[model samples]
Target chain A: MTGGRLAVRKTYKLFIGGAFPRSESGRTLELEGYNVARASRKDAREAVVAARKAFGGWSAATAYNRGQVLYRLAETMETRAGAFAAACTGRREVARAIDRVVWYAGWADKLAQVLGSANPVAGPYFNFTIPEPTGVVAIIAPTEPALDGLVARLAPAVVGGNAVIILASDDHPLAAIELAEAVATSDVPGGVVNVLTGLRSELAPVLAAHMDVNAIDVTGADGDVAALEVLAAENVKRVVRAREDRSPWEIASFMELKTVWHPIGR
Target chain B: MTDLQKRGDRSPVPTDWTYAPAPESTDIVRLQERYGLYVGGEWLETKDQFTTIAPRDESPLAEVGQASEADVQNAVAAAREAFKSWSKLPATERAKYLFRIARILAERSREFAVLESLNGGKPIKESRDVDLPLAAAHFFYYAGWADKLEYAYPNRSPKPLGVAGQIIPWNFPLLMLAWKIAPALACGNTVVLKPAETTPLTALLFADVCRQAEVPPGVVNIVTGDGSTGAHLVRSEGIGKVAFTGSTEVGKAIQRELAGRDISLTLELGGKAANIVFEDCALDQAVEGIVNGIYFNQGHVCCAGSRLLVQESIHDQLVRKLKRRMSTLRVGDPLDKNTDVGAINSKAQLDRITELVQAGTDEGAELYQPPCRLPEKGWWFAPTVFTNVAQSHRIAQEEIFGPVLSVLTFRTPDEAVEKANNTMYGLSAGIWTEKGSRILWMADRLRAGVVWGNTFNRFDPASPFGGYKESGFGREGGRHGLEAYLRFE
Candidate 1:
């Protein structure tokens, strides 16, 4: 060793269908002192296809199973808190992110009771309404407090059984890819959570316009939310902005209420 | 092949069992010669006007004002001005106005029912039994919620969203108005409502009901016109939210126009629902449900079960029974109490249905129209059932919005779910099965907003009603309906 101990740098890549793969475009952008994969529009489209393919089983899974998977996500992150603190944000943010995941995990089984209702409808029918996932939701992760903000959006969405394809913060993309790594090991079935990193301008519009995408969380969208919402309207997508407060309503934003009616007969 | 064999060899409906005309009297409704825009609790005259006609015989009922851009501006200003006091009123005070409106509606139910039939072309049986009562019930329902706003959305303070711009379809004019106005007013939001061009009379009459209930001036405004008027109202400034119940095309346009803006929107759009009848279903009860599912309101309902997906094994028996039952339906005057199906809403809608039915025939599906004599005076379409319909058939995919049913068969429940949900619309679906477990299982799989088991085309104010996917979003009934009008703090 001529001067110092050898240091091996980590390779940052795109996560699709639970696998870390180089951007299909084989593109990379130099950020700070590292090279990060720059996802292409085609990459965003593929992520949507992956998410849609996984939606059935992921959404159909019992809420308790989803809750356990999400809680395991917290456990996985807790073990990697030091790495996330070094790679993304401070230790406090990492701990909060893990705690936030555990918080949403508890909501997985209780969302129906809180959001659903057994109506006293004026009829000879038993009528009730329950919340169901809005299917494949695309999120734009916030730049600051990257891990905390990303988990804030991702946990609520997946807790409601939605398969997600998130666009990580361009400047803070490492934490998201790292979170995807955690997701892969957290028993969140493959493709249920796909992470794409690239120029927000390049990837946000593609995800916004994807027909298979049912709802979009524009919380971290850079000044282009108006444009993104316009594109989202092409498929009548549910457009939601960042909620100022953390609550179950945030989860409800990504869900569709389904009402069922049955004849009350002897 | 003989006509009988072509029709699946159904026995003829006995002519001797004809219903003698038991017509409801039209004298109860007193329509004004000319109606003006109801803005700020007063009738304001406008130069532009259109005649709303009784679709039963093409008779002119009243002259309705065509709200111009300037008129819409006045309505919005009125609603905005009203919102100041209306939103600030004691919640209990607000509740009383709605209770009064509901009471007034029930008191004058007959008049509204006759006018709804005369102006909207739905049967008196429906307007009296279903539409009028439901309309009043919506008011009664939301009235109770006015003071309970704190409990509706947990951990959030609910506040009114100022003025709401609501555009309702002609199919269920008065009821749609109630659906739009009640919760809105209950949530403390003033509304600027535009009734469909063909059916503006009932809404104008509702304006009088508001006055009778002593609702605050400018709290409720009625702007009557066609699509242009609705467009103007939608684009008008001072509207905090837009609630539209119409075709998906218009709903999409509204969405695009509101894009990049801060206004909230909810659309209740079109649907081509599947009414699946399983082999294990009670055949006769399923037959009645099938008929009611498609023929209700002349199939003008957005959630109409226009596509019948029958289990392959029971297809023949169900079709035969459905055909025989359809033959007994009396398609006649909307004012006739015995009329099972009323006149089509308008000539334009009738043409749309005719064109789609022709497409079904051209695409190699067998069409069955019961031998009922359609009246010559106004637009009418015979209750139609198309069998041997392919999943790809236009009639199976499109919302005919008339008395039409397209029948297709499925061998398995998985195939039934696949075929039922293949469409772009997911407003509602019907499952006919005596098996309880299968009903719940199928209900979980059908990608629809509303699922009706062993029954169809049912509605209640306490029950949430809306769609999934392209049929549009935001529920219009029940506690869930409150979300659209209130902004959480």
Candidate 2:
């Protein structure tokens, strides 16, 4: 190691179609005084294409399997907490990030319980209710607390089995790229989570109004909330408004409900 | 014959200056106090009655049965009673009813359009074309969801809310009805519907259509009246859920009334949607969106793009194009074939529009109007636009609900998004851009419920639509639309 600092390795790239590559537009931006990867509009479109390819199978995953995968992700994230924390600007954020992963992992099984309930419906046929995830969520990670907030926002969505296209915060994106590496090495299937780091003013609307993005999370978005809300409406994507005081446990807010109805036949 | 006698002999002086179309015996659905509130397969009546008027000339159209507090209670009771069986029906069977309703509406399209125009004061072309077709498509689209609720709410049973009390607005009477009723019915909930008092004709006609479609009685009840009637329906102890589409003021009132009640409510209220035109946008397309945004349906649209935010670089050129396009808009009798804008829905509404337009001028925003004539007897307001409008002006902030546009300009993309989102309402917005990157970027920042790119006010049944923030909550279309009518268990 040079000067007692860990020898840095690997240049992060855009995650698309189960492979990592420099953006098709061949664009890169300087982050933290280093030439880090930046995604192009084409790369964003490719992420969408990959998300579309993965949506059906991923969304079709059984709740139990989804729960298991989420749990596994939490386990993997726990082991790599030091790396994630080191990537972030501080240590408090890393702890919160790990806590967020655990919190969301637990919700994989419990969300259906909270958002779904047995309907005391009027008719004789047995009726029950559940919540379902809106597919292929496109997330604009909160600009601050790049790693923890992003993890908190994205974990619940994926725990609920939503494929995601996350546009990492433009200013501090290394953490996001690192998080993507963590996801890649984990058992999480490719295309289930895509990370694009670029100017949000450049990529958000594409994700928001994208015909394919089923929902969007602007939890970290600061300004122009109304414009993003409107753009997501083009395809009627379910939008999660940004919350300034959101905590790690709040990840459960993104979980989809699924209600199951079984007849009480004698 | 003498000269005077010859003049009299000339077609007897065409006695009735107003055009009179033949009245159809089959189409008339009589309004009466004893009319059964259609709920759960039964017709029940309330003790009260309210008069519905023709906005065309402010004449009494009919005395519609007002839902009593008890009537609301009874209707909700029936709906709740029916929800078990109805909600249990396979999504496919539920969709069949919606599909049938869509077909029936289409088959009776002409009759519905005429009655809609007569009741709501919208132009015949709009009623016949935009409103009716979209209404039919809404039902048809939701009908597909009857079986697909599984897919819609995957891994979960999407149960129906027991009883939904839906109130529709007068602007797009039939279409609003479809927006509320189609989704509710498809989601397998019984509904007590209150059509805006001024526009009850098409809804009553719809009841008849429901009867024809063999939609079991009590599944959908039509209670026609004014705010009092709507308020009573909303406050009734029986309703499990409430959905209202109208002015934001009234939406807040409904919310207040239901505040302590154990009911889920969705309000599709007002919007001052911003239609932003960038310097590089296709000028002709942006101009078309501008006209559609403000002039469509005489600007009574809640999500109408009333605030025109153009880039400063293209402001002059865009305004010139907009003015030229406005000149071509034909404003006249709703019955006329060439009319683009129709009469204001009612006298009160017209007065409000006129008052706001005057305020725009009084505030020093320069007003421009295309040369157009207004009908003397009915409520009418010419298509109007105000330039040099400050972002802080009342005219720019408030929803005028008439064919009025407020013009403001911004210099940068950040400024455009800032100006576009500076509103209490977040219903819908429009962005005109040829650059694909910018389109996506801008869309992500807008907080409105829907964003139209390259087009304005283009609504489809397959797409979900609704507002964010005070523009109201809950969506009205698509798979996402089902959530409004369904319950999560």
Candidate 3:
């Protein structure tokens, strides 16, 4: 009975606020012989709404708490690394992607000390600077090394207390949906890491112009980054054009420096 | 009567106390009849020129050149050429140039201060005490870092980004120029700087100081113009980094213009800051903090505490005290050392402040401006306070970059935090409380970049200053400021 039975195919859909829902437009793009959810501008907007809703609690969470959740995310990805490998390019890439997530996971609590400083400001004042999240960040995930590039960009942003709405790699979006499945099953909260599989040209501009979105990482942005930058300027959004490297500075790029001063008085 | 004023402490005033005239002599600054653009270490003239007036008396100070696209291009090319040598100079040599500039600025501080107050309409006290000293201190602070770049950022080699294009605001003209030029120069980058149209004198004066310091040609170029000139400098092909300090509107425009270009940018934009007063706070000290927070420099500060959030229990007492203190603030000739509030920067700025104040009154809030008379001819706005202001009021929400303060009441710390952050801008916030734990708590919760606890409007060269949201990005002071001018290898 088992030998003749047909295997059911997976219906890839958009991950919005942690839920695997089909795109509101009910559109799909054929890629690698699979139907992937083709997200609309409205879908990108909804993702931002969800991300904004999650921001207050997530950003307020202690760095230690954020670190723990990110660590759990790595563990969840490791368990499903085989599936991730099958969806993306290869096993080496999936392994690197999962390892990169763990690397960023460790930086969640340590970024403040490395990136922030206490100032000996020449006054009777105690001054210190700390890095705070830049709120909802929109990540344009890269195409090649799909899983690794997305994790490299996504982990740093999320680790620093920012909620993300990622426009997954347009060509290799299956890996993104698969990663979203792992995110849903992990300790990461809903709306924390939203995945939209669609045309970068269609979706990137909407996210760039969204007023609620505080920062953008265009590491994966393809063609006319200037146009996207122009849209990002409407809100004075922090535009990060970073390389695909795993560093605390990548996390710092999405964090704002907040310096507090108090007079040392009796 | 408004709700809180009914219960406000209405103390009687004595009539006899008044300060004697103490005007700083304007004879110290001998202004030239005409000034040209400082390009490639030379004063070059342009056919297009505009007269810069002293806002204090609307007297034309000097005719300064208006930089055209060609002028801007020439400036950029000069800066680009200079970058080859400047960026290659030994870091120690760079440090020496900066140290010399700092010393010369300190030596000529009074002349620069007089010109700053005369041109920018800031009080002599601020231009003399706050602006000049801080401007000199910024160069001194970044000067030490020039030779010590490796110690600033570990593991990464910090190198200068070439040909920084800097645009500064009318407020604190010399100080903003110092902020822009010091770090760029300390990092071994050549710069083409555009000072604000109304207050280009100090910058052009500082150009003379650059010459005295024997800085190489093309190392620092001063192009004086309005926004169009700034736009040209931002879009120029040779610039590797752009740093601006002004309105959020212009910052966004610059960001859009530089979009897709492989150039770095840092913006010190606008702020609508909140100064929160707790019930248990030291009442007299809090009053002083509130007055200094918004009234300092005529509230032209990017981090001005324009919104005052008071505990509902002490709203009456605090507002009454604040008004009493604000009344004593002399708003008169900027040259008068006794003047606390000074002239508005320009007619356009005065119109903006007037329109916003009118909007506050029309929206049914109570407005209070003390019984001090403004001088007849010049642009002036009195130290203003608005009560019964809702969080949504235009006065409370917008960056009224003048001596205007909008006071809103909050019943709890959470409510105070909620209302404090309910703006598109988050440049700075202030907390007035005796309790140490509460100050830390409020500081943690406030979304602004700079938070002053039990004190307000305090800046130091070592303290990093910038904003969180639309108030713009990157810091201007301290170790973090180095990151903006440096490229990592």
lDDT of 2 at B132: 91
Q: How close is candidate 3 to the true structure, as a TM-score?
A: 0.96
Could you estimate the TM-score for every candidate? 0.97, 0.66, 0.96
**Candidate with best DockQ:** 3
Regions of model 3 farther than 4 Å from truth: A1-3, B1-16
Worst 10 residues of 1 chain B by lDDT: B1-10
Q: Report per-candidate TM-score of chain A alone.
A: 0.97, 0.88, 0.97
Could you give candidate 2's per-residue lDDT for residues A36-98 as a string of tens digits? Answer: 777777788889989878876776677777777776776777777777776786778887787
lDDT of 3 by residue, A38-79 (tens): 999999999999999998889888889999898898899999
Q: lDDT tens string, model 1, A1-266? A: 33687777789999998889899999998875679999999999999989999999999999999999999999999888887987676899998899899999999999999999999988788899999999999999888878899888998899999999999998888899779888888899999999999898899999888889999899888886888888988878899776654689999999999999977888
lDDT of each: 0.92, 0.75, 0.91
Best candidate per lDDT, number? Answer: 1
Question: B123-209, model 2: which lDDT tens digit per residue?
Answer: 888888888998998898888877777776665567777788889888888898999988888878888888887787788778788
Task: List fnat, each candidate.
Answer: 0.73, 0.00, 0.91
- CA error at residue A180 for candidate 1, angstroms: 0.6
**What docking tier does model 1 reach?**
medium
